[model samples]
Target: MKKYNNLAEGPDGFVYTARLPLSSATLNWLSCLIRGHLKKIGSWWRALSAGRIAGIVLAVLRCDQRPSDLAGGNGVHRTTVSRWVREVVGLLAARAPRLDRALKKIARSGGGVVLLDGSLIRTPRRTGTETRKNYSGKHKCHGLLVIALTDDKGRLVWVSAVRPGRTSEITACRHYKLTAHLRAAGLGAIADLGFVGLDDGGPDADPAVIKCSAVPAQRKARRDYENRVSTLGAPA
Candidate 1:
């Protein structure tokens, strides 16, 4: 995580290390974007370049290392790395408006079908009241649930805010009003059996917003089709 001082330049440009997991061009672009935003804040730290900060964040995420471990590797204080991570997250959140606009445009163009699914991110087991809320019966672990949306090609388009592990996938989607947003953008959505009741709307409902593919009546056929859809809809 320490600044990659001995960077080797390939024919394409400066080469990123395996741990960083980004092309040099992409790193540079992200650095510029992050730097521009930091400059607007009067108290932004000037000790590290935007590229270095971004590299640290990427390394931590790719390796799934704790902030303290990342700081030790990067030869920086733990608090410093933690602050950098928070800043990077805030910067990305600030760009949501632009990201949403682009997604809406893509949906309207009918570029691909939207697939909805839920996943759990593991968390440490808690005690007392918190334990029940974070325990996931299906996963047999304590975690937070996240509903994700991906295009037909399996590219992530949107992700709902994290909910407790006990929260049903459909319930989370309703809280986020995901169907309304998709319908407003004139996009269709497909989901697994877990979202079976999603299409059941009143007389005023628009059926196109949620498209449930027919599951074969035969047990073997239904299982095969479910497996196929699961493979296709798996998040990238």
Candidate 2:
């Protein structure tokens, strides 16, 4: 009987969602991942005694606020908050190699999906690059090339971000290389149009791999009609 297990109304007009058993399971998994990182860095003892650095970092990832706001929320200084973020980046870099093998094992077990997509993150105003603009369609805004992979139901699994808006989506895809990992692990992948044609005759492309298409069709009207029909029949 968890105290917060039942749904309630929030101060805002929206519903307060109940935390599912799966949410707890996922949090436990995330805790394990953080603990593993602390152990690898030989800071497990420090992490346990020095306060909830990993928890704050996770909160930053989950929340809509800035890092400073996250720090305040966790009752730590902004610099300490930034350090926690840095540690997360370091841990991810170290763990990325391990992920390949783990993904392969998961794929072998069968029936998973990897969704790849990108979104624009505006440049920090303090960064000098913010001044350099590109004018193609609208006023050229400096943006990040963000790629993320998720399960079919949209649970985030992996993420990568790069600066320089000119960085090709295909290059970003190849660099992250989740497709091969998913295939090896027994997972399917769904990617948008930017990732289409990547498998076409490049030295890096693998023609044999199977990936689910999240890519938009060239015939937009027909695709929209089909999409409406699919949405209507989708299980509630």
Candidate 3:
């Protein structure tokens, strides 16, 4: 197999073109954040440029490229790429605001309500008793249940901790004390039927979260709803 740069790489691999999928500004921001974090810990040097490091993490995160491929491209061990990914992800997670804090911010900004929804976050299946615990009868797969709150414009504001996928979304909200928090913040939530009973529409319940219109109880409708929710969290 012969290799060429332009029309073809050869019988072994074909040449292809792609866009970065993220803006230059986003890449630069990630690089700066990583650099600042390293500096704060008194680390001085890295084999790859901060921008390049950001690119590697983004490729794996955004493009779903494999770590082994990324390692080969950068001439580093696969473990090194994994480590960088862990580091970057941890840093970003730490910076995300807590649910209460985000709610307060939205309230202060004069926002009336937030959109709340639950998703079945996909997870790899493991053998044993754990499988039954993580398995969702609705989706018929193993995953975690996660509640997410988004602004009216669909921007993510907060996400709940992972729970067993078998847990009902309405039950998950109660566990999180979401209604109390929303009331305290003087905010409401608009949720899908999964959270139909999240708020009782009582007169005393100020700024009550409203549930969307109910879907039919037919088995096909139920399955369709579950399928749509599962797809929202499935990896590309």
Candidate 4:
């Protein structure tokens, strides 16, 4: 078989190179899942192969390529690519483990505190007051907020529901009652200062959620000390 990089088309235009930032095993797994989904939906066949449809979705997601660009390369309509992406995304989303279940699994495995993080998924800033709720003043951008937790090995175990961009990490956690969930699961978390006050009752009240309350100011002070040391050409 021709290598991925050497799949460019010639006069026949029957072959072309496409780059997907995922391994072959991942691609094959996704193709298998899509094929299974098609079987369940009573679709015996499609114009495009399951592998190709999987490739289109992976390109749009992992590679962050536009659907139109993928469509042109794959000889399909842009809407087809978009549809494939949505279908595959929904399929995979249905398989994601719930936060409580994921945390319980980690706890049973004798794992320690997990890492917590949050980020915004950027969206186009259209000129409309209706979209004001999506504007995040902290990041000075428009997007959706999402929170995630990873195991000790840095594998994602849980993800929070999508919230407005204006939402803070701590606020989202509280909204979801993440503290009660973590305490119930017997798991702890180490998060950045963004979640400083996540545990309203304080760390002692719920030691499951550890924060830097003892030396909160030390984070900034350490950074300032490092900058001064570098400027003075001395080690402090």
lDDT of each: 0.70, 0.54, 0.81, 0.79
lDDT by residue for model 2 (51-116), tens: 355455556666534677655555557887787677776766766535465555445544354456
Q: TM-score for all predictions?
A: 0.74, 0.53, 0.79, 0.81
Each candidate: RMSD to true structure? 9.7, 11.5, 8.6, 10.1
Tens digits of per-residue lDDT, candidate 1, 1-236, equal 68877757554343223455568886787688788887777557755778887878777766676787666555678999988888877777766543355458666565534778899999999989989998998899999999887777787777766799988888888887776676666555777677877655566865433434456566775676555545433221
Per-residue lDDT over 26-123 for candidate 4, one digit per residue giving the tens place of the 0 to 100 score: 98999999999999999997769999898878888997888987787778889988888999999999998988999888877877567788889999
lDDT of model 2 at residue 192?
52
Number of backbone-clashing residue pairs for each candidate, in the order shown: 1, 4, 0, 0
Model 4 TM-score relative to the real fold: 0.81
- Candidate 1 residue 78 Cα shift, in angstroms, is 0.6
Off by over 4 Å in 4: 1-16, 202-204, 213-236
- When summed lDDT is taken over every stretch of 10 residues in candidate 2, the lowest stretch is 130-139
Ranking by lDDT: 3, 4, 1, 2
Output the number of the TM-score-best candidate: 4
Candidate rank order under TM-score: 4, 3, 1, 2
